[model samples]
Target: MRDPAMIETVAVIGLGTIGTGWVARFAAAGLAVRAFDPDAAQREALPEAIRQVLRDGGHGEAAEALRLSLHDTLEEAVSGADFIQENVPERQAIKADVLGRLDRAAPVDVIISTSTSGLMLGQFQEALSAPERTVVGHPFHPVYLMPLVEVVPGPRTAPEAADAAARFYERVGHVAVTLQKEAPGHLVNRLQAALWREAVACVEDGIASVEQVDKAVVNCLGPRWSVVGPHMAFHLGGGKGGLRHFVEQLGPGIQKRWNEFRTPDLAAMTDTLVRGVEEEAGGRDLNTLQRERDRKLSALLAHLAG
Candidate 1:
């Protein structure tokens, strides 16, 4: 684990959508941020976005006082950082090459984290010299709003490193959960894939429109998930029976349904078809849609807190 006292500077490599958000999150949590992006244009936008998000999230004065340093090269960015979060594109070969380079440049004490959604941390760390210090710190989109982060340790990772990583995320207001063992998709991806398969099947089978499918869960299940996860929700739902009672009564039905479930044929579904439905629901205006979703998520979070 990182020495709680020694942890201070944070470096974000490849300041794309997720990287920029990471900078905002760490900076908002009161850490000095060093950000790098090859595209100078995108790097230039970081300060303004960070400002707006902090202001919108009710930290206006702190946002104005936020200090963020932008660097041109990845090596320059991670030079003296205590932790380096890599957010490059998700191709294994590309990740291997970039991570190998970063490993050479960063200090031995710096912890390197990959933001790979489902890539195995052990596999990625193989390209690095001190693979034991590298870990997967995967965050969902809009990292600012979603506090849930999956901390996956490689096969060679030290418990101290994992412990330190978890503590850092929690210090920054994230609900960091360490996977007992690393696996593809970690936890959230598996849960999302299960729902995605069902949704795609429903759409392909003509059982519901895409809009209807999205709305069904977003309007109902989404709110619940924003607070408690599935297990706790079911525990409360079991009424007198609780979890054990639920398993005895509904477990068989679930197994039967699982056996009958079919995976969706992605090749059969065209982007045109998907976008056609999306357009019908005003999909062309992405900002409006994302804003609407964020508004709903914020409201739900506020209500849950109350």
Candidate 2:
């Protein structure tokens, strides 16, 4: 594995939301970025998009110092790259094809990382000539701002390669959680999907409106989770006895609630969910809402850092 300081050049493929964020982050960390996308418009707009993301994440000087180059082809982008961050479409076939090309073109030791949110790393590794160099580095949306990244190594991945990827992410100020085993949705996304299922069920059952459900999380669980995870929160809820006492006293009720939780029929509830979200948006455009969310995220991160 190369030293983190030696990883000065990175390739960012697919200049969509995640790819753009990766370009900004790598450039902000003082690595030269070679970014590529099939869409000419996206390629043209890449610099400004990255600039906005860096500025929004409170890295205005990094934005100013960002060293980036746009490329027309994957081979061109990764020719001299020390690491490759692939953000192609989520489909297995597409990812596999792109990763295969990267494996054939990139330096033999260059770690190829995927930003796949749900797909298992094994699905893409099969097509790579150097599968041992591939790993999953799944990150949350607005990757430039989010600190959490799930690092999952494929069955064929080298331990050193995974370690190098994690070290690189940490060097760029992200919290890289190395998973012990591969699973669908990795770790954080699985947790998020669980909460989302319940939130959607509440709306589907008419027990709460979309806005109400969001408010519940923002006002309570969100702030608490920002400080401590669920298990610790429950441990605190146990008072003198901690988790054991809480479980003994509240186990049955919790079990009953879990049993009662329904799997929402998404097809049937689509109209309701759409209408509810429209109401919640209250005519705010996506760009406006995204900017506001990023601003607040920056503030929260600053507070947490302090």
Candidate 3:
């Protein structure tokens, strides 16, 4: 049975990949989900996508009992929702427009969180009457399986609202990472972009092929990263003395020795990246790749759970 005190109804304001994932997870958690998307195909395809997500998570029984409703209009979707998740496109104008609409339509006290990967909530929250209740709840891809949700509050967002949103995500099986203040690309995305930029630089300068870089990560850093984050991993790298010794030993020379690349022109490298990724795919289509990824991800998650 569903928890009596848990929020009963969730409103998902888009039906794209992230939104569909959210809908699946919510339904699996026993919340009634109301969703709206302008695209007819996305709406039509959602039921099966949801089934796949639940199936990936071993929620096949929940898929049968899933209480998911599709609505034609945003207003109709947000109606009676105890919480709202906005996953519209990443444009500032579009997000502002959708958020403004949601602000007007959603119950005043309900929190509205965006699935924006990097946009700061302050940019669009100003147009809303309930800006205090608006926040950023950015999740990684495959939201049902990924544990982290970066919860960022706008300048106008109330502290209590941020706290409440974090608690809600935790309740639904997410690790809520709350930032003290929102930055240019939030937290994780910015870190990822930095590494991605460096990777492009590496390829541009002939330091490593795409395949080599990927192999290095997969065979070396990625496994360690799965277990320990940068600080802890580096601290362990310090032998017996830990972070203080590591910093003392390597801190001064770090920037001068390692900061050697400019962000390569993405346009110039587009073809290179595409060809490299294609070669890496080895003729496997997207569906096959996705299934393989999800399978491995499930095994890893189960091991982590134990």
Compare the candidates by TM-score and give the number of the best one.
Answer: 2
Q: Tell me how far the alpha carbon of residue 150 in candidate 3 is from the true structure, in angstroms, after superposition.
A: 0.3
* Candidate 3 positional error at 251, Å: 2.5
Ten-residue region with minimum lDDT total, candidate 3: 1-10
How do the residues 1-306 of candidate 1 rate in per-residue lDDT, one tens digit apiece? 457456788999888889988988887887888998888998999899899988877777769778789998888888778898899988888789888988898877678888899688788676678888788999988888787889998898877777788888888888899988898899899998889889888888888877788888977898787767899988877889897888788889988999999988877876735774675667457787788878877776667668
**Model 2 lDDT tens row, 81-144:** 8999999999878888888899999877899999998888887676778899898999888888
RMSD of each: 1.9, 1.3, 2.4
Quantify how close model 3 is to the true structure by its C-alpha RMSD in Å. Answer: 2.4
Candidate lDDT (C-alpha), each: 0.83, 0.89, 0.87
Model with the higher lDDT, candidate 1 or 2: 2
- Where in model 3 is the C-alpha error above 4 Å? 1-5
Error of 3 at 116 (Å): 1.1
Model 3 compared with the native: what TM-score? Answer: 0.95
In model 1, which range of ten residues has the least summed lDDT? Answer: 272-281
TM-score of each: 0.93, 0.96, 0.95
Report the lDDT of model 3 for residue 264: 88
